[model samples]
Target chain A: MGRIEERFTALKKEGRKTFVAYLTAGDPDLETTARLIPALEAAGVDIIEIGVPFSDPTADGPVIQAASQRALKRGATLAKILAMTASLRRTSGIPIVLFGYYNPILSYGPEKFAGEAAASGVDGILVVDLPPEEADELRCYTDPAGLAFITLIAPTTDPVRARKILRRATGFVYYISVTGVTGTAAPRADDVRSDVERLKRMTALPVAVGFGISTPGQAAAIAPLSDGIVVGSALVRLIGEKGTSDDLVPAATSFAGEIRRAIDAACPSQGKK
Target chain B: MIRTQPDRRGHFGIFGGRYAAETLMPALLELETAYRAARRDASFKKEFSFYLHEYAGRETPLYEARRLTETLGGAKIYLKREDMNHTGSHKINNTLGQVLLARRMGKKKVIAETGAGQHGVATATAAALFGMECRIFMGEEDIRRQAHNVFRMKILGAEVTPVDAGTATLKDAMNEAMRDWVSSVRDTFYVIGTTAGPHPYPVMVRDFQSVIGREARRQILKKEGRLPDLLIACVGGGSNALGLFYPFLADPAVAMTGVEAAGKGLDTALHAASITAGRVGVLHGNKTYLLQDEHGQVRDAYAIAAGLDYPGVGPEHAWLHATGRARYVSVTDEEAVEAFVALSRQEGITPALESAHAVAWAMKTAPAMAKDKIAIINLSGRGDKDAETIAESREEKE
Candidate 1:
């Protein structure tokens, strides 16, 4: 199994919910991003979604969009992000998913990107704009390279289409908790719970709820409803606010640690029958 | 015979596809189904025709510019007078069609993105006529540049939302509009102004605007006893160009040219010449030639004409360029300005700066061709809104 499937399987067996933390690569610079990876892992982050900044992030809200601009202005490219991943692989075995739009990957040459990304110890990739109908080109390469192609399921997705999307899905399903862009509005726990339950019945793949998830209270409320929760714009917003500080790593770790503790306390999956 | 393109899945030779957020996919699919049904429903066709003819003033003239031909001293030049449309541009053609579709789909709110504000004004006007809520997303830069159109949109009862992101131009406005659609998909209808965006949109907009080509084809045959030797139009997101070019795609003898805005020069980091100085990449939900950096980050496109300041071209234009069916060229801001003034003086017709790019290229090429050969420039919009910008530019030059 790939690292993504293996990680989910191991977590499921342990009766523990996962925490996926996202950070925009090269927000201030790659070195700070490198430092935050281990920091996030230390704070109980299960998977790391390194956002590859694009000039136009239409799917993101103001927080992530501003973070992307900062990263792009700092001269971050897909090549540098991959090199950072390769370097990070030397000391860490954390599952890393490169998250961004498709244009950068298309610019990198899909075949070459798939090969190099796999060689760089990347686990999966979630292209926000590429739906299953248009994913064949990138999947043809990433699938053979053992890289999981993470698919997003929106609230607007009808069940019939969801089933089709799930069938082709390899990695865990990313359930966008809201219909709007990331971090724009909070997802209601009641609304997310039923969707998570419905998704669980459809596929064996783990369902991770993301988008508009911020505070520990929200995380705690959502933790028991899904296999995992992705906190992106929240963490990205924090990093943007504290990136220039001397204690940026500590601040990020503590912030993520609060949400991790909240999830574990709320779910308490360990030792459950 | 019609030249079929965009197939059912909206692929124009692998250039156009539905590359959008998952939240918007269902809406796109819903739109496609509704559009397919509307295409077949005779009532929908009749209503669309009624609005085009009675409301938006269809059948704009195809007038011969004898003075322009004499000044250029070459091929006889004809002007396809899209400027005489009800809203002062060809944008009304697509807006009226989409607004009608929105009403048929039971949508009560309509939103659109505009750079030059022509599309925004068109959408606003249609919404007012239909009694629907209207909102327009315009870039901050464009809003400042095209204050006249912004005021027109406001006067038409549409809320103008300024997008402060990403160079504050048409691309940013489009991004903001898509974001709005994502959240408001249940009730709001996004009226894309150009022949870009995902499936159904490019095809739908092109279909609505193709009336220009159909009328020109018929009128040219009557006036010249044959088809024109060449057709010229400026390409922003390429709606006007495609409108005039789609009906003639199957004609082997007729030639077409799309002019892109080279803001300063192609060598500089500034031009909007996507097909001429761009690489094949995806943007605004369609795969096309885009102005992007080596790292695949989209570069901000610059043009004095706000309408032509987008970094990407329509996907079909990319396909047409790739297949060698149409030629694409670029004209600098200076050349466009010269043509803008020349057309005003020679023909007593003030062309929008966007359309002046086409006039500039025709001036260069038509002079080299035989006098008997004919060329038609799609005067995509009137320049009343651009009078201030032109005056300011002239002042700077002086």
Candidate 2:
């Protein structure tokens, strides 16, 4: 099994919900990103989603959009990010997912990207704009490379289409908790709970809720309902604020630790079925 | 045989598809189903035609530009007078059709993205007729440049939201509109203004705007008793060009040219000539030629005409270019300005800056052709909205 599947299996057996932390790969620069990854792992982040910056981030709100601009201006490219991921694999075993738009991968050539990304210890990819109807071009290559093609399920997704989407999904499903762009609006826990329950009944694969998830309180409220929860804009916002400061890594690490504690507190392992 | 394009899934070869986020997927599917049904329903057709004829003033004339022809001293020139439409452009044709669709789908709110604010005004006009709430997203830079059309949109009861991100142009405005649609997909209908965006949109917009070509075909037959040898139109998001070109795809004798905006020059970084100077990539949910860097990041496109200043063209244009069915060329800002002035002086008609690109190309190509050869230029809009920009340019030159 790939690292994403293995990590989920371990977390399920341990009766602990997975905590996925997202950071733009070259926010201030790739060096800061490389340093933050290990620090986040030490602070109990189960998965790290490295955001590859793009010129236009339609699905993201201002925070992540600004983060993308900063990263792009600093000369971030997919090849360099893959190289960084390969280097980080020399020491760390934490599951890593490259999260961004599809154009960069297309520009880099999909066949080559899948091979390089998988060989670089990247476990999965989540392209924000590439829906199931448009995923085949990349999936045909990524599947053979053993890189999980993570699918996103939104609040607007009906059950029929959800099943259609799940048929090709490999890594844990990312459920966008709200109908809006990332980092905007707060999703109510009650609404997410029902959707999560419905998705759970459909697929045995884990469903990790994301989008509009920020506060530890929000993560705690969403923890027990699914296999995992993804924290993106909040951590990205924090990084944007402290990206130039000396305390950037520590601040991000502490933030991840806080979210981890919150999830554990809300859904303790001993109470698992 | 040539007309059978964009298979059921909306791919024109490898160009157009639904590349939107998952949140918008179900909505896109729903829209596709509705649009397909509407295409078959005669009543939907009747209502759309009713609005186009009675409200938007359809059957706009195809006038022989005798002065322009005589001045050029070569090919006979005809202008498909889309500027004579009620909203002073061809945009109303698509907006009227889409607003009717919105009403049929029970959508109470309509949102759109505009560059020169022409589409925004057109959408707002349709929304007012249907009593639906309307909103428009325009680039901050374009909002300033095209303030006249922005005010016109406001007068038509649409909220104008200025997008400040990513060079603050048409692409950024589209990004903002998509974000809004994601949040409000339940009750809102996103009326994409051009022949771009995801699936059904390109096909739907093309179908609605094809009225221009249909009318021109009939009018030309009546006037000249023969089809024009060449068709030319300016391409921004390429709606007008596609509208004029789709009907003539089966006519082997007819030739077509799409004029892109070459801002400063083609060699410079500032230009919107996507097909002329672009790579195949995806942006705004369609795989087409995009003005992007080697690393796949889209670059800002520049043009004196706000309407033509987009980084990407419609997917159908990309297909046409790929198949060599239509020729794509570019006109620089200086050349377009010259055409804009010449047409006003020669024909007493002030063409929109966007349409001036086509006029400029016609000026270059018409003079070299035989006097008996006929050419038709799609005069997509009027220059009333561009008076300020034109004045500013003249002042700078003086």
Candidate 3:
């Protein structure tokens, strides 16, 4: 609670919106992803969310789901993902958050996961399907080990649920930008902005907007209202089209710079984007 | 004595094997070795017995059904009352032992699949007792029909995740639960609640449930002076029947009879009479007689008893049937109802509709045997839960 609160205050004082970039660890290739991660942090990503692929990802849309399949087919496992993070930890101290559903986490026992994630320089984890009510034991591992567990709050969540998430969540609260699966929509600028506004009244935890935000304008629009804007499929979609590691690195950085500029102007007093 | 040593490589004579996902192989092997070691150790059995008696409430009474027996007229009928076991049905016997095994193995979470919600309730009970997290996967339809059990599970601190793909019944729920088990075998114990599924589970669950037969053996010997002429019990996955009959297979004087629900009839599309109308194929991790199509789609089979309506019997039962160690028979819905009413009036015992099929078979068969000879039916569950369905179906039958 204290770390997340402190992070929010620091980011607010700096007047820089958080830039979160999510990518499947072994999506294109495990080795390629290892190189891609540090570059992402350098590209202005405040936090890196690396997805550990599973066979069934109920919450993700077709593009990310296909990427997960590709990752898993190349023998993408928890060990491989952990090994990738270990390699990336040499020089990178940027907060790394492992993201996936419960299956992979349960596959890798919780205590072992916390120890390894801490060893590999991972700061947090976000299980997409394990809601706040269900996340207590998972946090038992993370809290004792000093690893952050970022929790998600959906559009469907009522006030009580919002409070429950507020009480239960650690690290940063993931404010899903829309009603449904990831990568299925282009961002709705004002709706996301209002959702973030609604969340601010409830909790002091830093809110990072995720799900449908893609392109420079949407990121720029969301930046003003949020502590961070999480960009996932849009970047993965870019990598898929280019189909090469060489150009994708520079492209990711350029996109981050664009989103960063939006965050610069995205203050409460600055008015609407 | 129980057949403790299965084989060198976990096979029960080419029937059981650890053919699963690559990740699960190590965990399955570990479970096999631990189970073997635990059974051999004396202290483990002593503790299990203590829990079986104190915590789980074993050794349910065997009551004579005077009306049911006289109507059949073949032999005197008695019911080994498993329905009276704490938490209802024989499922708790296996779950308590398995949860203890899970703690011994140092696993902390419990996961299982249930169709009729009985197994789910039992697993949830064990999880609550051990103070371990529990998750049960049930079909979407079952979640609605067994909604009370769903609430019961949640109140007991187990999460009931509704599986909503394919047929969305027992088999599909099993598939979903297995998928979770394969990935998370280290942290969780997969508590299968029957004498079905793959290797070790069928054998393991049967052994836990052997309390049913062990108790019945003692009770029948004391009550009847000699073992009954025929030992009749219902076969769904064959846990209660196997628990009762398998121990007495060596007792040649006690003829073993397994009653399967005739369902609608022997007509392949209607009933759950697997041994009578099914072929040998691999389903639910065991090579056994199954009610499945050529392409391996599990067909919808019906029975008055929700528990006995499953399409596959345990492989060990198939072997027993093949080797002539046991005889298999089927009882229809109307006949089962008559037995239900007869037991309710004669002995004031409301047997589970599934267990009623066995009582029904006993009623029909006992009359033909010499009156001096005794017949015992495994009354696997009490009908307290079925008071509503029994009343309605009793009308539907009339």
Query: Candidate 1: where is the Cα deviation over 4 Å?
Result: A271-273
Off by over 4 Å in 2: A270-273
Q: If candidate 2 were superposed on the true structure by all CA atoms, what would the RMSD be? A: 1.0
Q: Judged by DockQ, which candidate is best?
A: 2
TM-score of chain A of each: 0.98, 0.98, 0.91
Q: Which ranges of candidate 3 are over 4 A from the true structure?
A: A1-273, B1-6, B391-398
CAPRI-wise, candidate 1 is high
Instruction: Name the 10 consecutive residues with the lowest summed lDDT in model 3 chain B.
Output: B16-25
DockQ (C-alpha based) per candidate is 0.87, 0.90, 0.02
Q: Against the true structure, what is each candidate's TM-score?
A: 0.99, 0.99, 0.60
Error of 3 at B219 (Å): 2.0
Q: Per-residue alpha-carbon lDDT of model 1 for A1-273, expressed as tens digits? A: 888888888888888888999889999899999989998998999999999999988898889999999999899999999999999999998999999999999999999999999999999999999998899989999999999999999999999999999999988999999989989999999999999899989999999999988999999999899999999999998899987799888889999999999988988765464
lDDT of 1 by residue, B1-398 (tens): 23677777899987999999899999999999999999999999999999999998888999999999998899999999999999899999999999999999999999999999999999999999999999999999999999999999999999999999988999999999998888889999999999999997999999999999999999999988999899999998999999999999999889999999998899999899999999999887889999998889999999999999999989999999999999999999999999999999999999999999999999999999999999999999999999888888989989
